[model samples]
Target: MSSDLCGSRLFLALPDDILTIITSSFSPGDLCNLGLTCPGLDSFMSSHKVWLFQCDKLGLVPYTTLIEWRKGVFSYKALCRFLVNIQPMIGTWVHRNPELRHVVYVMPGFLSVVGCRIIPQEIGPLGLEDGPILWTPVFEILCNHVGSTSFFLHGKERGVDYVYPGLLKSVDRDCNVLLLEVEHRHQRGGGKLADLKNFTHEADNEVSSSQRIVGRKWTEKPFICLESDDRELLLEFVTSQVRDIVPDAANVLLFPRPRIDAVDSQQDFIVLHERRLLLLQMYERGNMNHDLKSDEGSPLNPTELGSSEISKSVDCTCNYPASQAAETKEFYSCKHWPYMYESLSAFYKFPIRAPKACDEEYAGLWGGTFGLPPSADKPGKPLFLIYISYEESEGKQQMIANKILDGKSRLSPFNGSTMFIVNIDEPSMTIFPWNTDQQSNPISVMQSFKGEGICYWSRHRYPSIEPGSLFVLENGLLVYLWEHAREVLTLKRLYLGELLKRGERLPSFPPVLNFAHLTS
Candidate 1:
């Protein structure tokens, strides 16, 4: 026989188990390439047993978990596809404004990926990880039984939790921002569905060929600044679907905090799996029945569909309207609001990563409180989560401080309001406000810049920008002094994700409060 024929015969003669073992060493790319060489290798590569190994080897899930998950997916290959597709998005995600509230930790959920926001809190006597972390559902990217993924935004309206369904614009492999906005999809006339399928991509391609039909308008942006009443109504329309109640029993953490091994979290995966299935059902039923109302759950004229659908949608998902003409834009578009930027999409890209040890040094998340630094002898002040970013106005580089979260009162500076702005190029020649800090140590100044800070016309009254000095303390503290009021704001750089991981948990608010925080 010819050498090539002999080699083919030898390869085909190997036992299935041995051949599968040999093929296991090949990378997914190599295996795919090998499959194209011949019918036998193609058949060998497609084996369920082969992919079961691949799925386990992929490390997204354990072998035992993979076996259980295999029951839900189309195939092990599809499960692997899902795992590989979502791997990049499994880390942490955050936003600048609404400070402490915008830090969302994205992790694996049953058969989906869930984004959970860490609630602002103080450490309890229980100490760190010993305390349960308080979190509320933000959004979930769920996979259907057929392995198709769906995006659902959770909120509450008038004491009821609801899920808003929308199409994914894109899941950037290196996406830094997670935005919620309405996409105006204008499908083309006479475009064949077959043409759409032809362009069907692998998983995580939220904008599909069906979405990108011939002659279709390409408006793949969501960071829109909503200001007018019509804009809020338009945003409301995006999230106004599928009313349901979130169960109290479902108020468990993404991973149980009490256990070090995450044993409980893994076991609860089945619960999340069921919850995911229920959310998918509610989404399907809501899509089928536009006027989906349930009294037991969401408000706005409730009806009786299935008794348990709403609670299952988000475990404890609180459904609320995504409307706040002013803050509505903040939730999706992260631009310095009220001021219309040249490009709605371009402005949302803040925290452009300026260098350290310079005027641009004061960039990123910070934790601050009014008054002197904390003393064990005295209780600490309310934690203010601040987002510091840089921008250029007219000609000079300016640093903007926007408060995204206020542990004290939501109305003080308003969510997404700029707390201060400093001209990076202009250093203040003024003397330090205090020669001593809280500890009475000589306050060494690293750098100082002239700036403007938010000071109310009266305590908790009208806000006004007052002359201030932004000080970079030698000890790595940022203290802003409003010269007119003689007010001092002290801040320390924060590692929020670490805090969330170590923070304690509290009882979740009802769906309306948990999801949207629009309730008392």
Candidate 2:
């Protein structure tokens, strides 16, 4: 029997380690077929070691982290499932708004993945690699033991750090977009359960005092907690205000606010309203999904149906005082207020176009100059260079226009830079203001503004007194126009180092604001 087994053509005849490496070479789609060949082969193929190797090959996370992450998950196979699904999100993502070149680097964070934005900064001498990437906390997806995820957004204001919690939506293996949306959680689970539990316990203890005041108005009634219907009504009211503030808004209904009717006094109402406003603005500033320029590569709108289903599970029935309930409602409402506006509830869909994949036509280094139109008294002003690339994030293909400072040009270098992420399929992109109190939807720059030059380019009309757009010309040259085309910069594709060499250098931000300092 031993001789027969030894002479047989059996895959198990090879050593385990060697067999595992060989199995790892097969595509994941082929693993099931290989496993079904025989019981012995199935057992061998299903081994954790083989899947562990597969996970390592993905290179999204380190082997040590994968090993540690394994302890929290069911098996190496499940761990591999998580890693592959999140691989597309591990690269660099940028936005055209904010004029700060906000670059989001999605990396491994503990048992989950984190998307950290390199704060808008001035370019430093070290350049991209050696320069310390000073990044601020943006959003993170915390994985559960079962590989499910929860989303949390980070915010800082007045020296205080706040975590705006939400949930993961439409996250599948092929999902291209990562939507951190405000969802009502019926079950207390994940990393944030403890903090919520503690808050609930504290609410219970404080309810006695506030109940005395609230009991007087509703002694006869049961005084039930605010229901989903109540919150929906309040959300409708808030959304109406949002529409009034920004007429022709496209995705204003993305935020689902909860009604905090527990406000017993005028002070509570003021405090809660103030808190709500601040949280909503912060979420509006951070939630960039609606403003994304591309969606052609996206599979489906996962949030389309899932948001209502999950929001239905939201139960604010904690046994807290009226004031506490109000505060809690405010808290939950704010979660969706800021970043929750993911176009999940958008009535109108933005235009789509065939993507220009990061090919040679328009996906490399570009240099230009910005000045008044040639017809203007001063046609040439500042020498500018831009880096154009095709990037994918949240399941969309974007034409990213990133501004770079030129040190070799005759003009002094600019202090700040701008990045514009445009959808390849659509002829338009949104332009956001640098600093403004108004919460405006992205202004479409789909229309072309023809200038006196030999080239023709498209520009958008902005509400601001001074409007600008990254105008791409019929020629190879790219232009940046500001102040209604009064200031324009024409750029031709060139090497960044050469442009910096021939360009005059200027002072940039401090180490923290510049890429000189790295954040842990």
Ten residues in a row with the worst lDDT in model 2? Answer: 321-330
- What tens digits encode model 1's per-residue C-alpha lDDT throughout 343-374? 12111223334347865567777766666442
Instruction: Tell me the TM-score of each prediction against the true structure.
Output: 0.54, 0.40
C-alpha positional error of residue 197 in candidate 1 after TM-score superposition, expressed in Å: 28
Best by lDDT: 1
Model 2: CA > 4 A from native: 1-9, 29-39, 62-75, 94-103, 124-131, 157-159, 172-176, 184-520
Q: Name the candidate that leads on TM-score.
A: 1
lDDT of 2 by residue, 1-520 (tens): 5665752235688898788777777876577687787787778778988888888998866686577567666888777766765665554443322234334446665555655544433334443323332345455555555555544444432233334334344444333233221232333453232333233222344334333222221222332332323322222221211111111221111111123344433343344334333334433353422211213432222222123222122221221101101011111211011122222211111111233554425665554443433111112233333556565667765555545343332222222233344454444342322221113322232233322221222354322224345555443345445534355555566532222212232222321122111111
lDDT of 2 at 99: 32
